[model samples]
Target: MDDQQNDAAGQAATRHAADRVLDAGALRALAHPLRVRIYDILSQYGPQTASTLAEHLGESSGSTSYHLRALARHALIQECADRGSGRERWWERPVGGVSFTRPAGARTPSERSATQLVMSEFFRHRQDRLLDFVMHSEEAEEDDWSKGAMVSTATARLTPEQLEELSGRIMAIIDETVDRHRDQKGERVRPVSIRADLFPLATLEESS
Candidate 1:
């Protein structure tokens, strides 16, 4: 995959982007663990074909192809018209954030189930990535990355309004930084995962 082309596509996609909130159908479509993995790979690594995905996933090309088509039917993934030839199709995830948060309404049991599954798989994947990096950091961490890296945790108490405000501020900073550097390419440049997680922990009473 060409990094520059991928970044250019990402820049264009972000320029016209609105966060995609998964509907019940899309939620169900992505509830499978393999599908979630496929989606995550494209998001993190850029465009790929079914064969390439299978190579990364340790699954058969036929199996990956089937899931890829299922995802495409829901417009969660699309064929790269500029990249594929004949039966060899290249697929890429459309850039921008995808929210699993349901809108204000009553959701069916199936929808709720789908939501849980999707969220579970997505978070599990994130956890695996974090663990992988930590496990190999001794060998993989270059001087620059090690110096630039941060891994810390802090706890704070705040009201819902305060928390919301803080979250908005954090996201604004992230968005600005990403927008400014989304298209950056250089000999030393690399893809970095920037994660932000902000949520209220359960009170002692609630836990009990």
Candidate 2:
């Protein structure tokens, strides 16, 4: 089965852009790894119940329920109607997804702490995903499987404005491709993540 042809159910998951900027309160609430994991699963897989989420994440229902409530408190997620007559309440990412920024100057200790904690989680999550794939790539023991996973680096010289334009175009293409194939499904298809980073290396003068 072609990789993209599979994962129709995963592709069917609603795509929500991050429209809501997180305030300090929301940032603090999202700083926990478990909370972030919960949010990621819900956002990627669509609506989920605490019990179901707990099962997937290997946590207790009570623990998952607590984190779900905390996320809901900041409106990162909202309650949805139950599936059938089930007692478990389903929750989903808010209509628009969530976002964050470092706090402004004159920050309180709590504000600084929250931002640091949240950013740490962000880096950890990204690195962990790549590391996990690397550790398991050989286990797949297939050319296609190994080739399917990869990392690439490219460098270019350009003015700030030109760089921004280039980045925008590249990102647009990626987004379009992902969206076009978002809902495809096949037995061999599986979920994959695409991450991109573009930044200018610091010049000696700038460093000084």
Candidate 3:
């Protein structure tokens, strides 16, 4: 087998071995903004000390350490054996990926509110990062950059069934593409954010 095939197979194996579901408590624990940020950092850079995480997030060491412990409590992350002096602890995300889902039991009003708050904060954080990138691109060449730009919005005439099928296809395409390129490594290539958003159009009556 080729190098690409070997890498793909290895990733598939790792993904299969990883946990695919998060309990409500685990999801709630991971929903915190600081914890999410720390997870993203660790996923990109591997294990890191709390001090290092604090420096990267511009947070106090105490605050970062607290959040790290909360994440550990939920099994979202774990202490790594490789680092830390006598007192400090280094950590890494334990699972290959985290999947969020509504639990089996009906959610209480408070639980529903908590879930909404968590999702809202997560998306707001993502939107802020996208806005920051656009705002900071003043020095970038317009013509050169325009070639790499994309802005697409469409309103399709389709039944609900068709819409559902389309959504599933789109998600599958995204998953495949992300999995394909996830393990590529080189000095010239670095991490790039690829965000996808999909939702049904709101009716005029609903808007009014």
TM-score of each: 0.84, 0.76, 0.72
Task: State model 3's lDDT.
Answer: 0.70
Mark the regions of model 1 whose C-alpha exceeds 4 Å error after superposition: 1-18, 102-106, 140-142
Q: In candidate 1, what are the lDDT values of residues 147-193, reduced to their tens digit?
A: 68777778999899777556655666677688788768889888788
Best model per TM-score? 1
Judging by TM-score, tell me the better candidate of 1 and 2: 1
Q: lDDT of all predictions, in order shown? A: 0.82, 0.74, 0.70
Pairs that collide, model 2: 5-185, 5-186, 6-185, 6-186, 8-184, 8-185, 11-182
lDDT of 3 by residue, 1-208 (tens): 4566455555554554464666668767876778878877777667888899989999999999999999899888899877776798889876355555443332566555546656676677777877876776665747555346554667787788766555555545555776787767887566666665666778999988
RMSD of each: 7.3, 7.3, 5.9
Q: Best candidate per lDDT, number?
A: 1
* Residue-level lDDT tens digits of model 2 in 98-207: 55665454167787777777777777877888888888878886868678776788889989977755665555556566768766788977667777788899998999
Worst 10 residues of 1 by lDDT: 8-17
Among residues 3 or more apart in sequence or in different chains, the pairs in candidate 1 whose N, CA or C atoms overlap within 3 Å are none
Reference-based TM-score, model 3: 0.72
Which 10 consecutive positions of candidate 3 have the poorest summed lDDT? Answer: 97-106
